[model samples]
Target: MTSPSDAPEGTEPGTEPGTEPGTEPGTVRPGGRTARVRAAVLEAAGDMLAEQGFHGLDLAEVARRAEVGKTTVYRRWGTVAGLVADLLTDMAEQSLPRAETGSLEGDLLANARLVRRTLSDPRQGPLFRAVIAAATGDARTAEALHRFYEVRVAEWAPCVREAVERGELPAGTDAAEVVRAVSAPLYYRLLTTDAPLDEDAARRAAAAAVAAARAGAFVRTP
Candidate 1:
């Protein structure tokens, strides 16, 4: 996934090009060699995370796998947590945009299906699980993960607002809440059971969110 790099076009904004201290995950993407290095490092890091979990992630190993110098990896991302946080930011930037299907049900169904596909993907599924598991104990990782979802929710919130305008949902239906509701069940299934995230499940998730939303279950409260 393409992440927002903290650098101007064709230049990395850090102590030494792509080194850390001032480099945040989302600012501007770097260009040329710096961009390639970042991409390679993150790609290698993701593969290792999917295969070895957080505890097994090593900066030296990541550098070796990415074919970059270990010193570069250490300088850019000082700690494992820092690297993971950047990885989450990259994922957020790479996520798909929300669907605009006109009807709430249609839109939510599309959302549910997208979640299903991502959560069920061979590579992404495990990667997400590993990151989520790591987030439970690491504060930085959790914050970065929150940012990822915030970006996605913000992207999809407009559909709920549009539905309100069309009278498909209540006037004050919590758009973000409704959007979250659409995916909650699918995520629950993914995390709790070995159930397949099939078309029927996606339909059910969308239908339930639509039903609850139409009934004002997601209305904002004090």
Candidate 2:
């Protein structure tokens, strides 16, 4: 797995830097230097992304910002799509651990709030929009975007499954889809409307999703 600092530079089809934060259970390594480098690269990439958009980025400039060699950037990530893929992977690996609130409603609420916060972030939202635009023209960029969401959904699926097991939700609920539902509106707000992504929105989304799950909206049809 790539570290935070190892994110490549570019705004091309595959050029998005990412960071993998947090620990991997049962895996240990002396990672101090590596972690610092990864963090530096990701931060620099984000700064560039927010300041200049995707088209404004170049690998050489990223190397300059990262204080690494252009060759190093090229060797690690060959294409723009490769860089974005690494960035997406780093994001997945480093994102906060999923919440386990012991109830589907609580967990979904937590997820909604977190998603709102992320999409509403001043730095991240524009960067995301830039990437989304880029993805429209690049298949690899689109794939990376899909994987990013997939990882997030998978991380929260257990909470939905647990609810089903506890009879708080009907059996046969597609846990990942249930998890995704809570964030759909949050992203909708981020992308479509200028509506504030406040606590109220988060709570409402979560409550609605939980209600839907209980009503068997998530059950897989035979």
Candidate 3:
């Protein structure tokens, strides 16, 4: 299993794949001081998730890491699971808009590339594994994990459905399933093996998914 890194830096959950936060205006806009505090808290939570695993996560510890008041952490996030759920929301909001690469192949590749980039990060990959392991034990964590992936898949599924509408793919294609296909192998690699989740693998997965979907893999056959 990939372990979370301590003080290891990678892309922020809310930022674009290649771009950092604060570089793009509409990418993320913290509304007020409280929102900023919440962001800091979530970052600290992410760090904790990667390094300590969820069972070891403490709101007070997160507050200390974020340099915020313990009361503030409790007030905002309520509990460790609550805090993690909110952090998942923050991560969803920060992910970049779906790529509009025109062709289904291009769009799928874009989606795969983005997933690979994020999950392959030095910090993020391990943190994800830790949280996933936590999810197996904690119902709340499992729900949060489900929501995180659901949001991500939804963000990218439109491209596939749009392709079908445009006649690039068969009608009645399962957009969400198509999107999942692109990342399924990457996750399998991340979970089952010690192989690096590399760019080539991401591209190949995307290509295969797009090709398979075009062949009606997601179509409802009579």
Candidate 4:
């Protein structure tokens, strides 16, 4: 959600990024000039969110910062919520894929460390805090945030499934819950405490989740 570059010239304006010429906007396949515009606009939006928060996000300012036409921004993104939602979508799409470390503990630790790094990053951390704060009072932003996490959680769920297959965890372990468990304490610490998210913290979170899953804490009961 944090990086964006300038849009190149010579493409049709106002078309959504990554949309095909003959297709509807949301049908969305990536290419060409529109992607550049999207990149620029999203970058501007992210910067603004990090600097000024959701209340400070202005479409005109975003358009000016991105060097994109104001009309194009209005036409494509419509509202602040829409723009923020797209930013989340882009972030999810740009995020790293799941780690395949061949063991539940390794994969969960990787997941924990990734969360720590992201939540600890200067730009990303503030951006997340702003979005999360905005989401508390905004339904659209909340939905977008939920979707973003859903995508991420789904990406890592397989590690728990694999652990179950290997009999390292009980049968019917709730894979998503196990994955969430690995990250929950980290987020709680991020929001509730002033402690450092060191590697040791990541390791501890992963270890605790693994222990819990092995104890059937995350097993689905009928």
Alpha-carbon local distance difference test for all models? 0.84, 0.74, 0.80, 0.86
Q: Order candidates by lDDT, high to low.
A: 4, 1, 3, 2
lDDT of 2 by residue, 42-121 (tens): 66676777778777767678778999766646644556666665666677788888898888878999999888887778
Query: What shift in Å separates residue 112 of candidate 3 from its native position after superposition?
Result: 0.4
lDDT of 3 at 59: 90
Model 1: lDDT equals 0.84
| Backbone clash count, each prediction separately | 0, 12, 2, 0
Instruction: Name the better of 1 and 4 by TM-score.
Output: 1
Indicate whether candidate 2 or candidate 3 has the larger lDDT: 3
- Candidate 3's displacement at residue 152, Å, is 1.5
TM-score sort, best first? 1, 4, 3, 2
Clashing pairs for predicted structure model 3, backbone only: 4-50, 14-94
- Residue pairs in steric clash, candidate 4? none
RMSD of each: 5.2, 8.2, 10.8, 5.4
The candidate scoring highest on lDDT is: 4
Tens-digit lDDT string for candidate 4 (140-182):
8999999999999999998899889998999889999999999
Model 1's TM-score against the true structure:
0.89
For model 1 the local lDDT of residue 103 reads 81
- What tens digits encode model 1's per-residue C-alpha lDDT throughout 1-222? 112374445544444354344655333365667778888988999999989888899999999999998766776677888888888888888888888777888889999999999999988888888998999999998998899899988999999999999988888889999999998999899889998889999999999999999998999877
Q: Superposing every Cα of model 4 onto the true structure, what RMSD results?
A: 5.4
Cα-lDDT of candidate 2: 0.74
Q: Pick the TM-score winner.
A: 1
